[model samples]
Target: MAGSRRGSRSSKKTADRKDKNSLLGRWLRRLIVAGVVVGLLGALALGTAVYFAERSLPSYSALMNSENGQTIVMRARDGTEIVSLGPSYGEWLYSDEIPQVMKDAMVSVEDRRFYSHIGVDPLGLLRAVWVAVRDDQRAEATSTITQQLARNIFLNSNRTMDRKLREAVLAMALEWKFSKDQILELYLNKVYFGGGAYGIDSASRKFFSHSARQLSTGEAAIIAGLVKAPSRYAPSADVNAAVARANVVLSQMRKYGALRADEAASVDVSAVKLKKESGGNSIRYFTDWALPQLDTLLADSDSREPIQVWTTIDIAKQKSATAAIKANAPKGAQGALVSLDRDGAVLAMVGGTDYVESNYNRAVSAVRQPGSAWKLFVYLAALEAGYTPDDRVVDEPTTIGNWSPHNSGGSYAGEIDVRSAFAYSKNTVAAQLGNDVGFGTVASMARRMGITTPISTYPSMVLGTSEVRVIDMARAFGEISAGGESVEPYGITKVETAKGRVLYRREPQRGHQLVPDYVAAGITDLLQTAVATGTGRAAQIGRPVAGKTGTTNSSKDGWFVGFSSGITTAVWMGRDDAKPVAGLYGGTAPARAFASYMRYAVKDRPVEQFDTDLQLPQWQLEPDDEYFYGDPNDYYFIDEQGNLVEPSGGADNGTKSPFPPERQEQSPADQPRRPSRDNETDDSAPSAASDDFLERAIGGSLENGSTRSNRPQQRSPSSESEMDTGRSWRSNPPEGIIERPD
Candidate 1:
């Protein structure tokens, strides 16, 4: 009976403990539930606050103000764009200006649901999110056209949370401020198309010669495809990539019902009409001529403002010059050309064989040694010293400095006239002239003539050892063409704003007289002989012309700089890296290019005679003086030591005298001008009897129109002892010898 009672009490106690545990568990569960509700409310409140905080507080509102700050205009200089440089090597077009077919293609390929979505597409985002969630990956953008424009215009290409946040915010703001059309238009305008074209207008004109409004379906689609990656899809650079991009656009267009499957398959992007030469690419040449002018006009401080530049570049001339260079330039060789007026108007400029291949302009940017072409200045210096075309000079071997320049034939002949020596391009004779004239005189003449390149006189400097560019060379010739007035090349004729406000006008920089008119005339005459009977024989035309041919020491640089009445042209051919060419010389390569260009340039214009021809007398071969040599094959002169020397130099520098010693004694009182006391060259002035002859000489004045003389060099006594053997006027020429005085 007692055991039964105890069992019943234990059961009662166990039941009471179970009830207590159940009640405590229920109470704890209710408290946890309450805490969870609070945490959920707080998280919701925080997310809402953060979203509202950034949404209303703006960072940038430049959509309108940015356009106000920058302007895009095409200048009149070959109709090239004057705009700020962007991050691509090519151009981009605005969406509205793009052809409908191109626009459809782009939208279809890049974003088919672009028009249907707001800044963010919910469906695309959901699909992306679902796929990412299923695969445990991250979601990128579900961007619409507006969103893309916002990204391109305002945000950088970063995938960071901050950048994405800003882009999303800007995109929303953009949607509020702009309609779909406006956003699409901005996107099209800002996206880059390869090949230096920025807008649809520029690209259409560049690729098809037509306006963007006229782009055909295939053409439009292909151009549109380029926007994704211009260089990758450029036809010239990578036709395969372009075709692939075109196919993708076509496929998207078909999916979007813009084109039928059959039509899309038949579309031949490869067959689309493409020009070999991009339109208005000629503007590239002006990069060298125009950029410097822009900096000068805008003072480099305000170049960002829109400015219209008017230049004298003739599209036709530039095109023709470029074509000639492209057709004739040797493989692996490049060239540049510049045509200017006597007034320094830059009529045409070609900076390279192909600006597409290189932007390093060579016409005005490259510097190369001028070779024998520089002898033109030396010849002018000789004219200043009173030497005439008929003056006898030996074509014998001569050494200037460390370099021993040889004649074209590599052998020396007997004496010849200055005209023939220059005509034949005798390096030895030119070096001898440097010996006669101080090198300083020649450099001064070049500097005065607007040659900005520093001139140094080495023995080979007479043969153009000093380096110079085509523009400087053209300017050097320009000074002669400018009637001895120095002129800086004029590029921008006038500058104006888009609002018709005149900003500035280029006042062509001109210098004081570089050389005496008569002396310049005489040099022009020698250069004329260069075209007529000399190395530049190819340069002769129906009208009077003067020019010089240049070749560097290793035949690396070739040049032909010449002028007539209205046009002065400089042509240069060489390797950009200064590598030697295949047996190329100036007379054959550059001379031909100059001839072709000049012929076509003047073909349409009325025949205009050379300006100086009227000012200078016609050349006439006069009768030889009694003292002149009888032998046609040879001439004689007195050496410094008084040994008889047969004439060696072409005209003036190398006369061979039967009597070794030069006659420096007092001339007959009847002489019009007294010869120099040194008596190295009796060329101060021609005798009165030879007046008509000097008038016919190469130089007309400052020789002051002296008669041409073939007088032998008369050696003086002190020349042997006073000067070093290496610096003697006869046996040894000075290091930087140039022209002697009248």
Candidate 2:
């Protein structure tokens, strides 16, 4: 009975074992089928992705002809290349034509298994994945040359899985369609090397100023290093960083046995020479200013070929202007200058002291208080009001509303002629003139003189409180230089393709007369006097120069805008933060820079004298004397017929002056009081009075003075708002008025 029971147990155990084995086999078979299904699905997904990616790929011909970006080469008026705006390209080179060292350097650094891989390196990919998984990091890219070429030709730089998949598929297609040498040749010709350069040939020529065939081992390594980060490793951007990267490439080459360790060590990175333009980066300012105009000129056209822009910039003058600013710009202060012809073609521009330090163009983009330079429009308005340069105006302390302007030194000439007042930059005279002519008339005059900035009709706006651009000042002065015609500043003269087919050519347009010829002559006469004997005396270069000096409150901005020999130039100096500079005045640094620049700019041009038929009052002062101190020979006394007459007695004669007997040798109490020096204020500060004060003050004087019967007749204002219903101020009229004699 025991034997039979044991047999039964054995049989049950055998059945249980069989059941366990069958269950194991079923699970194994299911797992195998599941793995097969997943593999097939992955294959189908990859196949579908590749099919779409392949269909979207560009044609082989397109790949060969691809460009990184449009190249716009800018040339000066003399046909010298100033700068290249877009990516520069060189002639395409085949595989054999490329230097072997360059090819070897690229292969060793970018991909060691480039020759062994079909399209992608499975070993490299697996190693990258294993390392990533083991180190818990992102997978490293292991792209072959074929993959890089594919990406450069047909793909944007996006790192998504979809993009990666497409990149791999296109890479495989490239490998299948072309041989390794062909693929390498295409890659070499299509890669970007930064500094606005594309392709090995362009990179080689740009950096070394030679063809790729002449690349030494070190040069090859340097160029190869740029492939990873073109901007960071470009020699022009940072030479030391580029050299360090080249050493890494040399190490890779040594490891791959392409270069012997000794040869690699002997490579002198310092021997690599770099190409530099004549004017350096400073010329970029002119190119930058011209590029936008080029875009506008080509806006209506549909041509996409590489273009050549012939700009009006003179490279020689550009260099001179840059040097002038660099040498004369005060330390810790920035300066900008713009030069224009009478017809308004930009001759040269210096946006800042250094283009590399900062590219913020102050010449055309930055607007600041023009200081007394803005008085150009004020005096022009006065001229339009029929006031002669010799007309007598009080320079005594005057107030409009609650605003009282003062002279630079707080010294007032009790009663002065208009020419001396303007030449000396008397704030009181400017304020009175703006009020007399109406602020609206002043603004209109500015607009007509090529000032596009919005002008406020504020009482202080007459003293250049409103912000204005340097280029606008140049254009305004250019209008005066052009003899009353409107001036429109322009840079680009022509645009054409590389094949010389003209796409856009600037057509000459006749400038409409913005100001009357007599008005232009009158203003020019005053400007010339200002430069000859006034605050702008430092800007004189032994030629007829017409300009004005301007300094804002606390010396925040200094300016000198002048014209000579048919050229108008404007120079400005100030801190970017609008902080006051110590001892800065428009007649000092700005005038010096103007003189320095104009000396070189006008050296080649013939001397031309101003054409004006208006006779000016003679007022002579010693060269050393800056202010008029009541010279008898320089005085113009009013005659019995109300016409101006020179002092007949001269300094030696003690003859009675031709003036009202009560006005001769008046005491301080009888004249307008000068403002206290300690309480002096900037002329640009707006009055604390009501906003309508400027409008009400127009065509009137706020001073207490008696009108003389011999006073010159005031011309009617341009509009109804500027009607003169108030009497002119003549406070304590001197026995004789100072004036410049012709």
Candidate 3:
């Protein structure tokens, strides 16, 4: 009975201890739950306070569409900044205009979860905090694209707790107010792009010399990579570092499937040509000349805000031309240069030696005597008057209306073809030809070609006595370069407002034919010969070139007007006071300048041959002339004018065909005659007379007025029927042939 009572007391004590332990555990769990609830409420209250605090800071309505400033930027054909008026505000672009590769690069490298995030990313923030603590980096940033835009345009950038809160709050507000594309557009245009560029357009022009819309993938990568540290990886500052950054962006793009592996590998970082930003003021003669025309170009527009002007000025060619003139011209003598494309777009223009010292535009305004350069118009008139290049004209001393023009140094070749006369620049022969063709006709021809200056119809005018601007000469030569189409030289292409509104635009007008194709071809050959072997030989560039050399009576002015298939340029060197330079001749200083500029200008262009064929038998051959003979074996083809044609095929190289085939040794009676019908009248029957037969065979007419189309006609030898219909073979030469060579 005692043992049983002791067991019962022990069991009661154990059960009481267990019940106390269970109650203690329940109280501990309730206290832990209450602490967690308080912590949650505190966090929610802090976030609410931060959101409202940022909401009261500033309004973003005015800053949304506001332009940075008003400015009129001028850009070259390649979108290089030539100059800017007022403050620099670069070109603006819509979000869609930015390349997809560029957009993808930005998203993949900058904010990978940009599209999915609601302005603030909590996971990214936690990762960023962990990384900062683990790596001991105080400058770590986890802001999304929206957060960046907020910091850039709305709030100031600072690495403080309060600033971070404000940035996050504003970013959330921006997310609610704008779409993803609008937010991205704001970010792209607002971010600093180094080199004083604030937007993608400005950055593109500053570094790549192109618009943002035209940026290549490599170029876009380089620009997008600049956002990390603009000054650190600026292409102009260090191209290698910029390229390295671009490769990183490209790799990130590939990792995100925004770009293919093959695309990333094929991108050539070296091929991204960057225009180095230059210091010091550029010569502004071209801008100064183009600026005055704004009134006329924008006459219809009423907006007076600053407008961007897109011009055809090639900065590379402009600098080359300026350097050429500065290096070749004499110390005190002023020089001017004008370069144009075949379509009459002004590629380069240097009005004076120093535009800061003198704004007087010599290339456009100064009208000086062209000297022998003016003889081109006289010769063109002679060609229009039915004179062949092979027709002989006397270079002897000739007196015309009390004016006896003599060749330079009293030297004259007694009898020479018009080609030789022009090549050698014989003044006497030119004056005689001018008188023969009538000075009025030459003046009219000059006006028709491109010379707008008033010309005096006199014998001295043939020697370039009339004053002409350098640009006019370039335009006339540009027509020749384009194979006979007249072009009006223009600089400014169009003007646009800051918002991309078209203020004014130039419409392309079709040019008219000033010189016939055959006449232009003949002139080109003669000019090419002049450049190859004549006085302008100093201007040879080891390529086919056509040019002329001009020196006035007292050496007061020297001019060299030349053209290739790509460009036409005119260089003039003279003193401002019209005083003579000691030894200035067109072939010396002017030609040297022309060659110096042309060598650099055409270095990147392909070597194109001239438009005309050099081996055609345009000249009548004398029996004793052995140097100008054609191939003796070519017998199957003939050109339109009954001259032997040289086919571009077969074993025969560039050799011309012999004038007459050896098979024509039989007498007239021995030759085969065509059969005639007995019922036909004598006039209707084919003629037996040599003159009539030759005329009938070639389809001759007294006054043929065939005009060549703008496109070049095919001259292949296989089109015999076509050639036979439009050909003319003169039984006797024209009236002005002086036959004897002295």
Instruction: Name the top TM-score candidate.
Output: 2
What stretches of model 2 exceed 4 Å from their correct place?
1-57, 60-65, 88-279, 615-742
* Candidate 3 C-alpha error for residue 248, in Å: 67
> Across residues 1-742, which tens digit of lDDT does each residue of candidate 1 receive?
8999999999999999999999998988988888899999976874564456436633333442243123434354566543333322123344555577867876886678877775666788799899999999987566666666677665656678787666766676666656777667666655556554655666676677777778887877877788677656776555667778888788789988999889888888888877666433545667445755655676634544565666777777778888877776777999899999768888788888877655567888788888888887888777666666656677776765567777764656556667667766777888777777777877776666666687896566677877888998898888887767776787777777767777777675657787777667777777887787667877776777789888876778888889875689998999988999886678877888888888877776676554433132122112232234345444534333323344454323455433332222223443333223224344554332333322333235325332334445322234545545423332222222221100
In model 1, the runs with Cα more than 4 Å from the true position are 1-59, 63-65, 72-280, 300-305, 400-403, 507-511, 604-742
Model 2, position 136, has a per-residue lDDT of: 100
Q: What is the model-wide C-alpha lDDT for candidate 3?
A: 0.75
Runs off by more than 4 Å, candidate 3:
1-70, 87-282, 613-742
Total backbone clashes of candidate 3, pairs 3 or more residues apart or in separate chains: 0
Error in Å for residue 387 of model 3: 1.2
Q: Over the stretch 412-510, how does candidate 3's per-residue lDDT look in tens digits?
A: 666656777787788887887788778998999889988888899978899999999999999888888887888889988978887888887889979
lDDT of each: 0.67, 0.79, 0.75
| Model 2: per-residue Cα lDDT at residue 493 | 88
TM-scores of all predicted structures? 0.54, 0.57, 0.51
Q: What is the lDDT of residue 499 in candidate 3?
A: 82
Residue by residue across 1-742, what tens digits does model 2's lDDT show? Answer: 9999999999999999999999999999999999999999998987776667667666667777877767888899999887777877898888889989999999999988999887778998999999999999999987888888878777766778887877888887777667899889898888889867788999999899999988999999999999999867888767888899999999999999999989999998877888864445677778777786765787787666899999899988988898888887888999999999878999999999987656668998899999999999999988766566766677778899999987777767766667777777888889988887788999999988878788889899999988999999999999989888988899988899999999999899799988777778888888887787778888999899999999998888989999999999999999999999887888888998999989999999999999765542222211111233665565444333223343554222444344521112223333322211212232323222211222233334434432322333223244655443211212222333232110
- In model 3, which residue pairs have backbone atoms overlapping below 3 Å? none
The order by descending lDDT is 2, 3, 1
Q: What is the C-alpha RMSD of each candidate to the true structure, in Å?
A: 18.1, 16.0, 27.1
